[model samples]
Target chain A: MSRPLVLVVDDDILLVAMARSHLSAAGYSVADAQLGAEALDRLDERTPDAILLDIDLPDACGIDLLQRFKRRPELESVPVLMLTGKDDRESIVRAFEAGAIDYIRKPYIHYEMLARVGSQLRIGALMHELSERNGAMTRELDVAARVQRSFLPRVAEVAGATVAQRYRPTTALGGDMCGHFIAADGRLALFVLDIAGHGSGAAIVAVAASGVLQRAINERGLDAATLRGELSAFVDIERTGFYATLVVCMLDTRSGELQLLNWGHPPPLLLERGRTRWLSASGSPLGVGIGPACELQTLALGEGDRLLLYSDGVCDVARDGFELRAQALELALRDEPTPAAVAEAALAAAASETIEDDDMSLLVLQREAV
Target chain B: MATQVIGIEQGRLDTSSGDTLERRVADALAAGASEVAVSCGTLALVDSSGLGSLVRSLKRCRAQGVSFKLLDVTKPLLRLLEMTRLASAFEMEHSSRSGAKTSV
Candidate 1:
C-alpha cells in the first residue's frame, strides 16, 4: 500500500518545515500549503489521509476551511486537526463545531504531532477497509439475488396448462424459492418453499435446499414418502436450527389429476366453479426429525380449474394492522382471468396493507377448459 | 425434581428467537430442572427454524433423561404442530382450546 498522505496548512513557513520533517521521518508523505487557496488546490488534485489546519491562515480562517473540506462528499470522512495558538474555550468549541475532529495548541511538541497524525492515519486506513468490505458484500448479495431469481419457474408453454409465478424478497436475498420440472412420468412437478428467515443466510439455505430437493425429485420420482425421506437425510447436515417448509404439487395434464405433498407450509387453494377448497393435508416441515411419512393429497381437476400455491408470507398479509384470513386470500384469487392476473391481484391486496415482513412467493397452475 | 416453565411471548419463534429458546432450555437444564415445558399461549408464529429449535431442545432434554412438554398451545400453533406431525413428538399439557390452566 502507498504511504498515508498528510496535508498541512499554515502561514508559518518554519512550522510547516518542522511538521514536514517529523511526518516524513515517521513514514507519512507530507504536503505543505501556505495559503487556504493552496490547500484547496491540493485537495482538488488528490485526496489526503488527514489534514492539519492552522486556525489562523494567511488568506482564510481555518474553521471556515475545515467546513469547506467537510462539504466535499469525498473528503467528509477525512480527519482534520485544528492548529491554534489560543487555548480559549470558544475557539476550541468553534473548531469542533466546524467539523475539526481534534484541536492542537500551537507550539505543541513534535512527538505529539507525530502521535496524533499516526493515530488518525491508522483510523483512516481501517475505515477504508470497512468501506471496501461493505461494497464487496453488496456485490455478492446482488449476485445471490440473481441466482435466486433464476431458481423461479419460468413461464412454460405446457399443453392444456397455464402457469404463472410471482416473487418478492424482503431483502437483497430472500428465504423463499419456487421451482418446477417435468417428471419422467410426463407429470409437471412444481414446488414452493420458504426457509425460516429473511436475508443472506436464509437465502443460502434456500438455494441449497432447492438443489437437494431437485436431486431428490429426480431420484424419487413423484413419490412423496420417498422424497420426504431423502430430505430428512439432507436436514441432518444443515445448521442445528435451520429448516424449510415446502409444498410440492404434481399435475398430470392428460388426466387433470393433481397430487400434493404439503410439508408444514400453508395449505394450497383449489379454485373451481366459483368456490374454493383448501387442501390442508400437511406433514412436518423438512428437517424436523422425520416423523410420519407425508400423506399425498389428490384432487381431480375438471376443465377451467385453478391450483394456487404460495409461501406463508403471502397469506400473512395484514390490512390496517390486522392480519387477513386465509378466506380473504382465497377471495383475492377469485375471478382472475389468467394465472398471472390471479398472482397480481393477491400481490396488490398484500401491497395495499402494511408491507409484509417476510419473503413472498406465489405460483398458480390453471387447467385450460378449452 | 422441579419442572421449569418457559412462556412464549406474542412475537414469532423464527430465526431471530430460535437461539434464545435454545439458551433458555440450556439454562433450565443447568439449574437441575428435571423437566422443561414451553407455554405457547400467545405465540403468533412458529416457522421451520422455530420448530427446529424446539426439536433441538427436546433432544437435549432426552439426552439428559429429562422430560420436555408443551403447555397451553393455542389453536393455530396446535394446527402447525399437527400438520408438521410434531404433536406426537412431545407430551403436551392442557391446550388453550381445552380451557385448562395446568402448571408444569
Candidate 2:
C-alpha cells in the first residue's frame, strides 16, 4: 500500500520544507502549497489523506478554509491539523469549532506532531467504517418499514359493522400492529397489539406474533379461547424475551355476541345507549413467566354499540384529568357518533404536547342492528 | 391560558427562595402563577441535575393552576429533553422571541 499523503499549506517556506522532510522520513508522502488559494487549487486536482494547515495563510484564514473543507462531501472526512503561532486556549477551541481534527503550535516538535497525525488518521479510518455500516443498516430498515406497512389491513367495510383503523410507527419500523380477519361464517376477528419495544427487532417479533396469530385463526376459525392458548404457546416457544399486550375479539353478527381474549392489553371501551363501560379480561401478557391456561371473556353486543380496541399509547395520555384509561375513552367517545369519528376523537385525545416514544394503533368496530 | 415567563441566567434562577432549583420553581408557583414558561436560551449546558430541576418545575406547574411550557431552548438542551421524554411533557418553543407553535 502507498504511504498516506499529507498536504502542507503555509506561507512560511522554511516551515513547509521542514514539515515535508520530517513527514517523508516518517513514512508519509508530502505535498506543498504556498498559500490557501494554491491549496484549494491542489485539492481540486487530487485529494490528500490529511491536511497540515497554517492559521496565517496569505489568501485566506485557516478557519475559513476548514469550514469550506467541512462543507465538501469528499473532503469532510479528511483530517486537518491546524498550526498556529500561539498555544492559547481560545485559538485551540476556535480551531476545533472550525472542524480541525488537531492543532499544533508553531516551532513544533517532530515526535508530537507525528503522534497527533497518526491518531487522527486512525479516527478517520474508524469513522469511514462506521459510515458504511450505517448506510447498510438504513437500507435494511427501509425494507422492514415497507414490509410492516403491508401487514396492516386495508380500509374496508365489514358486512355487519363499520370499521376504522389508524397506525403510526414510532420509528422507521415499529412494534405496534393491528389486524382483522373475517371468517366464512360471518364472524369478524379483530386485534390490536403492542410489542414491548420499538424499532427493527421489535418489529420482527411483532411480525412473527402476527404470523402465529393468523395461522391459529385460519385453522381454528375465531375460537377465542383456542386462539389465545395457541398464541401463548407460540410466545413461550419463541423465547425472544419480548412481551406483547393483545386484545383479540370475535364479533358474531348473527347473534350480536362479542367474545374477547385480552392478554395484558388495555381494556376495550364498550359504548352503548349513551353509556360507556370498560370491557376487561384477566389474562397475563404473552412472553412473561408462563402460567395456567389463558381465559376468555364473553359479552353480548347490543344494537348501536361500538367497541374500541387500542394500544397503550392511547390510554397512557399524560394530560391532567386523563390518568385513568376509562376517563380517556370517555373524553374521546362523549360526542362521537360513528365508529370512524370515535377512532379519530380517541387519537386526538391521546395526542401529547410532543412526540410519543411508542407507536399508536387503533381499531374501532360498531355493530349495526338488523 | 395565562402566561408567566421565568428567566434563568448563568445557569441559576434569580429567585433564591430555596437551595435546589426545583424548590425555587415550586416557590415561584406558590407565589401565584397559572401558566409557567421557563426561558433557558442563555444556558450553555445542563447536567442531569439541571434536567431534574426542569422536570420538577413542570410538575409544580401542573400541580398549581398553571400549565407548563418552555421557551428559547438550545439544540443540545432540546436533545437532552427529548432523550428523557421531558420534551413531551411541556409546550416547547424554539425561542422566547418566537410565538409558541400549537403542536410539536
Candidate 3:
C-alpha cells in the first residue's frame, strides 16, 4: 500500500526541507509549500490527509488559513497541526479555536512530531470508519422499517366487520406492531403489542414477538389462553431482557363473542350503543416480573359494537395534563359505528410535532350484523 | 429553579428540585464563588437523566448562599426544560450580566 500523504506548509525553506525528510522517513508522502497562498493552491490540486502549518506565513497568518480551510467543503474534515514559536496559552487556545487539531513549538523533536502525526492519522481513520458504519446502519434501518411495515395488516373490510388500523414508529424502526388474521372458522383474531424498548434491538424483539404469536395461532387454534402462554414462554426462552405488552382478541364472527386477553398491555376500549368500558384481563406483561397464566376476558359484542386495541404510546401522549385515551375511543366510535373511522380519529388525536416519545399502533374492529 | 456556573466560559448548570444534580451544584458552590453565571450554550445533547441531574443541582444551589442565573439557553435545552416545567421556575436571560440585572 502507498504511504499516507502529509502536507507541510511553512515560509522557511530549511524547516520545510527538514519536515519533508522526517515525514518521508516515517513512511509518509511529503509535499511542501513555502507560503499560505501556495498551500491553498496546492490544496486546490490535491487534498492531503493532514497538514503541518506554521503560524506565521509569508502571505497570510496560519490562523486565517486554518479558518479558510475550515470553510472549504473539501478541506473541512482534514486535520491540521499548527507549528508556533511561543507556547503561550492564548496562542494555543486560539489555534484550537481556529480548528487546529494540535500544536507543536519551534525546534520540535522528530519523535514528538511523528507521534502527533500518527495520533491525528489514527483519529482520521477512526472517524472514517464511524461515518461508514453510520451509513450502513442507516440503510439497514430503512430496510427494517419497510419490512416491519409490510408485516402490518393493511386497511381492509372484514367479512362480518369494518376494520381500521394505524402504525407509527418513533424511530426509523420501532418495536410496536398490530396484525389480524381471519381464522379458518371465520373468527377474526387481531392483536396489538408494544415491546419494552425502541431502536433496532427492540425492533428485533417485536419481530420475534410477531413470530411467536403467529406460531401460537397456528398451533393452538385460537385458544387465547394457550396462545398467551406460548408467547410468554417464547419470550422467556429468548432471554432478550425485553418484555412486551399485548392485547389479543378473537372475535367469533358467527356468534359475535369476543375472547380478550390483555398481557400487561393497555386495556382495549370497547364501545357499544354509546357506552364505553375497558376490556380487562388478568396477566402480567410477557417476560416481566411474573409469568402467570393469562385469563381471557369474555365480552359479547352486539351489532355495531367496536373494539379498539392500542399500544401505551397513544395513551401516553400528553402535553400539560393526561389526555384520557379511553375517551378517544368513545369519541372515535361515537361519530361513526365503523372501525376505519375510529382508528383514524384516534391517530389524529395523538398526532404532534417531531419527536414522538414512543411507537404507536392501533387496531380497531367493529362487528356488523351478519 | 437553581442555576450554577463553572469555568471561565460560564458553562451552565440548571436544575430543579432533585437529588441527581445536587452533587454537581454543591461542588460548584463549594468552589467559593459568590454568584455563578450559567450559560446553556455548548450543552449539545441532554437525556431524561441529564435533565433530572440539572434539576437536582438547582435545588442544591438554592440551599447554599450562592445565587444562580441562566444565560444563552439553547433551543434543545429550553425544550427539555419546557417539557419538565423547569422553564417556568428559572429567570432566563440572553447573557450573564443581563441575568444578574433581572434578578430580584
Q: Rank candidates, DockQ, best first.
A: 1, 3, 2
Q: Alpha-carbon error at A290 in model 3, in Å?
A: 4.3
CA displacement after TM-score superposition, residue A157 of candidate 1 (Å): 1.7
Runs with alpha carbons beyond 4 Å of true place in candidate 2: A1-3, A24-29, A87-89, A198-202, A222-224, A237-242, A287-295, A300-304, A317-328, A336-341, A353-355, A368-370, B1-104
List model 2 lDDT by residue over B7-101, tens digit each.
66665322231125555456556666566667776655453235445655665576565777777776656654443334545688765353222
User: Could you give candidate 2's per-residue lDDT for residues A12-103 as a string of tens digits?
Assistant: 99999999999999999988899888998888978899999987788897888888888898898899999888655676688899888888
Show the lowest summed lDDT stretch of 10 residues, model 2 chain A: A316-325
Interface RMSD of each: 4.6, 14.6, 12.7
User: For this target, which candidate reaches the highest DockQ against the unseen true structure?
Assistant: 1
TM per candidate comes to 0.85, 0.68, 0.67
Question: Which pairs, if any, clash in model 2?
Answer: B34-B66
| Lowest lDDT 10-residue stretch of candidate 1 chain A | A316-325
Question: Candidate 3: how large is its RMSD?
Answer: 12.5
TM-score of chain A of each: 0.85, 0.84, 0.81
Task: Output DockQ, candidate 2.
Answer: 0.02
Q: Clashes in model 1: which pairs?
A: A284-B84
Model 2: per-residue Cα lDDT at residue B99: 26
How many steric clashes between backbone atoms does each model show? 1, 1, 4
In TM-score terms, candidate 3 sits at 0.67
Q: Identify the leading candidate in terms of lDDT.
A: 1
lDDT of 1 by residue, B1-104 (tens): 57777766745676557678888888888988888888876677776567777788888898899998887776666766765566788788864432212221
